[model samples]
Target chain A: MSMPKGSNIGQFVVIEEGVKLGENVTIGHHTVILKDTVIGDNVTIGCNCVVGVRKSRNQNMRISNSSLDPLVIQANCKIGNHVSIYSGTTIAQDVFIADHASIRENVEVGPGTIIGRGAIIELNTKIGHDCTIQTLAYVTGDTTIEDHVFIGPCVSMSNDKYMGAREYTLKGPYIQEGAKIGNNATLLPGITIGSSAVVGAGSVVTKDVADFKTVVGSPAKDIRYLVSKEVSEHDTTT
Target chain B: MSMPKGSNIGQFVVIEEGVKLGENVTIGHHTVILKDTVIGDNVTIGCNCVVGVRKSRNQNMRISNSSLDPLVIQANCKIGNHVSIYSGTTIAQDVFIADHASIRENVEVGPGTIIGRGAIIELNTKIGHDCTIQTLAYVTGDTTIEDHVFIGPCVSMSNDKYMGAREYTLKGPYIQEGAKIGNNATLLPGITIGSSAVVGAGSVVTKDVADFKTVVGSPAKDIRYLVSKEVSEHDTTT
Candidate 1:
């Protein structure tokens, strides 16, 4: 396969065959882009990143022998250092995936999302547009996050309520539009965060959160609202 | 220097000089082992791992010139993919460090410990034998995790109470023997988790946890008596 036009690659990069890149892409040092990966224009991937790898982790190990599909990175996305994007994933345009983030296989992340540093988006997750998953969050598998959601730093979502006893099928949270999960919150399996709901920091959410409600504490209970505020002091994407 | 006898080195591996490997050590693809690393017998390191590197991250960036010691990995350890172990650390035998686990420099991890997937044990941490640091947990710098302690998933421990304001000296928690920290729990700096105590899931611990007590919620308060269970259900090292 021929190299795409105007793609600048750094030292010790290993790009396998059948990988395609668009123009003005900057691939950083010590990156390994595996086969059947496609990159769009104006993408900048940082150092020590691994794109389209077959994941070997215990929670998200998926190595498909049946005609491996391509991992696609859309235009204007910025991938940070030491990131790992597995195969069978499609990142939409203008996404900013931060450093040490791991996007597992069969995931679909929509446009304008910011996956924060050291966050783990597990297998088969679907994240929609304008979402912000903050630093060190653990988003479990089979999750569906809708548009404009904000998952805070160190938020932990679980797919296994029984802790891998295999009693139930694994399913992560279904976060609706504009829902906000605070830092260090824990969402149990298969729960739904309603539109504009707020799960407070360090909360353990054991049930579904209704629309515009605010929940706090362990087995998070609803509290009366004091004041309405914007999601963050500053917007993530300018 | 010649390759170590019966050691299986993978393709495109970058091993520097004066690194010693024992018999039956299997190093996977795209791994970079730096100088002065000593790997013992029957060690299995997975793909894209960086062992014994001079770390570049903040709070662990110690490229020592005076008395630069080698990183030592003892026998029968299993290191998973994309893991990073910094220099001047010693990992004892039969430890299982899972995928994306980062152990920083000047640290010592004892035998039979399970450093779980995506867990980050920061600089100068000392973890004893039979400890379970579960998935995505963040053990901050200068911590001491004693034997038979079970630190749960996404448990966050901090060293800097001043939020990097440089007011007080930084120190993480000292978790004593047989302590159990539940999922999404946050431990404040310079605190002590006493022996056989249980910090409940999603709790924000502001002070020291007493022995044999169970603490819950923000500024965690204790509940009444519960039977002390062993931290590990089964022994990690047979």
Candidate 2:
């Protein structure tokens, strides 16, 4: 129930006790900031957002009642409307999370990331700096994304091989640095997208994509090398 | 505000003036119904929903201050939690819109249409009766979906050719009757899916699909005819 100095909160908003907010924060209407949450300076949260909420739906979630580290949002972040950000997550500075996006518990998102509208980042995922997760994309649980990665709209990355039965060791995709995944692409579980690789739109990547390669179509065959000097020169000329 | 007989309104529900509600409607907590909205009998609207909202952000939208038709929802439709339905939309009877689904303005959804969880139907789309739009699917604007069409999970339909550059008469894919689009498939703009056509999982449909054809892969080639007599005979024999 403690409000930091110079912070502006909108109507019908609820900020519980032990929630630490920094200066110059603007919280929009109908937002709920739960207990043990922490926000840094110059943050803007839009309307109808639920921050630090517990994952009540997942039966297998590693939910702890013991005192733990609060959900943290670093400086200069913009959170859009109708977003649900769960507990035990840390978001770095200069992050833009757009409307209707959901980020589950135990996730760490690095600085300068843009999570687009309606995107869902599931539990236990770690996304590095300068990444772009486009609109309506799904980054499944336990995924690891390196810096400068771009995931286009409607991209879906799965984690579980055997869906919803007895759970095996559910490991998601590992996307390396400078990788680009185009629109409507599906990455199967435990696969690796190598550095600087380009996955074309609507590709179903079943196996590991090699570095500097472009993959397309179902089961995603390697089409061409992505990082030729001629290609860079051609781009500069264009 | 006129309360119809035998309707149950939950806590924090906001229904504006000139909104007409039918009998036995159950509106959950924190749901907002704007002005000029008309609701039919036995409709169950879940929590945290925003209905009949105008698209305030689109500067190119056809916004009018004059009198217009109210947003309409017919009887016995179940709207799930956290949904946003815009104005100038009509949802027919027995339609089930699942959680986190967003239906935009000027859309007409026919009876018995199942819009699955997290599906987004863009503006001015018309979906016919008994159509199934599965979870996390995106139905782009200016689309026509016929009866008994099944769009599987994570399917994406795009309406742009130039993609936010100069728009070329943006029209989405037209899905004919009994067409089935499998999981994670993508449909490019201005394409027609003929009757009883089946698009395989992870397919990228760039052209028109013929009637009764089963297409697969990127640029979706026809792999087989769906309605063979031998298949029907085998099914009956089994």
Candidate 3:
């Protein structure tokens, strides 16, 4: 194999043949880039991160594993160290995945989304563009998060009514466009947060939340109506 | 620094000055043993695991970054691959730490304890000998788990009550000896599980459990008496 002139490759990096590496892609020490993984231009992969590694063969466990699908991170995305993006996850252009975040298999994160540090997105979730999933929040399986939504820190989204035992007939909950979920909130399965709705912090959402309304408390009740137009006008003036 | 004859060194593993490796110790690929981290004889470190790496310089993240503590895995302990045993975690002899488990700073696992795969034992939590923590369980800060305790999979032991904007003191919980917690259970803070008590699956324990009692349901109540003597006699006869 011929060497590239003036390229700094760290120790323990396995750059397999046919894997494309963009210019100025700096992989840190002890990081492993497996075969068939593609890196875009100017990507900074930090120390001890594993990219393109195969998932562990243990099926009975639900802990984070490397994805089998081809992971594609678009140009100019900032991926922090210790971030494990499982297989079949496609990070769109200009996305920022913070440190210690775990994105499971087959997730389609749209462009301009910012996944906060230590946030866990379970398998098969589809997040739309420009969304912000905050720190320490958990979005469980098969949830659909629309574009421009804001999920606060430590918010929990559940997929099964019975925790990991009874599978729900329907898929998990859906959060429509422009909705905001507060910190430490819980969203039950089969529920929906309507467009522009607001869920209060520490609320356990047991039912659907109507659009432009703010709900709070356990088994969350509608507290007040938030006028979207008035808020937009206030935003425009400010 | 003179090279010893017939020494087997794995690729990308850096053994700095003053570090000692006993004979027949197998260092897997990409595993870094930093300065002054000692490995006993007959130790087997799996692949892609980082030992004695410097901590990230984040101060307020609840993760202790000072490497003032050295990780000492005693002889004959079987540590699985991809396990991150941070600084200050001491694994006694014959301890079995499974894959993907995170033993954070200042934690100690007694000998013959099997920490299940993907279990997160937070800082300052001391797990006694012969205890089995099941997969995906989270044992948080300052908690003490005594000997022969079985914490089931995905069980969450919380440290805070009156959560989310409530002004309450956050106290630690205690799990006494020979307790068994079923899968997906939640234990509130400051509550003690008496010796040989059994908490059923999917139960949320809000109060202390009495010794040799069986508890079930949400906000778990006492269901029946756990016949400890009878069970012990059956075990002896078998």
Candidate 4:
């Protein structure tokens, strides 16, 4: 078979056939790009990042069949080292995926979003444009996050209340536009954070948060409105 | 400034001065090794794994400082692609870190251990030798896992009972040698798992588990002695 063409692929870099790559797409050494993967122009994929497809195995049990769809990465995207964009993931244009982030199967990330380092975006999640998902946050399946939202470090969002062994359905949660979720907060499934809402750090959110409201404590109760002072201070520091 | 000698960095890889790399080391493309990190000999660092670290910002708030000390990776280790071994982490010899695993600061992984793919070992935890930490598990801080332990996928271990914003003194919870923890199990702080103990899948363990016993369900109760038949069957399938 003829050698696949790229700018530079270091030793042990595996790229399957039918994978389309745009100009100036630099893939680091030992990176694996599976079949049918499409990468856009000026994209920099860091070393050791696994793109495209994989099978799901559970302790000797083949829990799910192997994935088939190609990963589609848009133009001008900067993917950091060690980022695993799993099968059936579609990353939109101008997205910045930081180091060590895990984007699981069938997840769609909108354009201009920044997936922070070590962030975990679970399967079947839809993240909107211009969102900033911070480091080490966990976004579970069937969740929808709107545009310009900010999720803090170690934020945990759940999909199941009474988690079980077999497959069960829990209603998907929604995080509206411009919302800010604090560090180490847990949001139960089927909840909604309205536009511009703020969930405080370490809070356990059980119910819906109203638009522009600020919630705090366990089973999060609305404390007050989000002050402009806090927002301004946050902007200056960043 | 002159680059540090013996730094086996690949093409398109950048390493700031003062970063030390041992013999026969391979660094993948577009991977950056920041200052003050030390990597040992015969270490296979996979593509896109970020060594050393950076701080994270949320909504302009300097949430938690995720800064770690210079990372030290020991000899004969196999680190998978896209794994993030953060600062202040010391990985002992003969360790296997799978793809997409995130090991945060101040964690010490003993020799001959296997950290599965997508597992997150949080700060200040001590994992013993010859242990198997499964995929997608979240292990919080100050926990002690003894040698020959087996931790299954999606297991959650916390440091606090009433988890809140305040900083509480975290004592080490003990997992004795040869213990086996099942998938999606939750372990509360200050609890102990005795030697050769077994925790079933999807259980919320609120108390201590006795040695050589098998525990299941919420507030994990001892069901019976762990049979060799079950263990052998489980081993073959995984």
lDDT string for model 2 (B111-224, tens) is 999999989887778999999999989898889999999999989877666433354887889999999999988887789999999999978998999899899877687774
Q: Taking the tens digit of each residue's C-alpha lDDT, what string does model 2 give over A1-238?
A: 6667889986678898888899999886678999989899989886679998866757665564421557899998888668889888999998888669899888889998888669999888999998888779899988999998888778889998888687598899999998988778889999999998988778889999989888877778877433365488798979
Candidates in order have lDDT scores of 0.83, 0.85, 0.71, 0.76
Off by more than 4 A, model 4 = A1-12, A59-66, A165-167, A170-172, A225-238, B1-98, B102-117, B120-136, B140-189, B192-238
Candidate 2 global lDDT: 0.85
iRMSD computed for candidate 2 = 3.5
Sort candidate 3 into its docking category: incorrect
**Candidate 1 on A174-217: residue-level lDDT in tens?**
99999999998888778999999999987889789899999987
- Model 1: what is its DockQ? 0.24
Candidate 3 chain B worst ten-residue window by lDDT:
B53-62
Q: How good is chain A of candidate 4, measured by TM-score?
A: 0.86
DockQ of candidate 3, scored on C-alphas against the true complex (2 decimals): 0.06
Which lDDT tens digits does candidate 3 get at residues A79-188?
65456776567778768775557887778899778886557888778999888786557998889999988886557787777766765453678999989886557899
Could you tell me every candidate's TM-score relative to the true structure? Answer: 0.75, 0.72, 0.63, 0.56
| Consecutive 10-residue window with the lowest summed lDDT within model 2 chain A | A60-69
TM-score of chain B of each: 0.89, 0.90, 0.82, 0.83
Model 4 lDDT at residue A230: 68
The lDDT of model 3 is: 0.71
**lDDT for predicted candidate 1 compared with the true structure:** 0.83
The positional error of residue A45 in candidate 3, measured at the CA in angstroms, is: 4.6
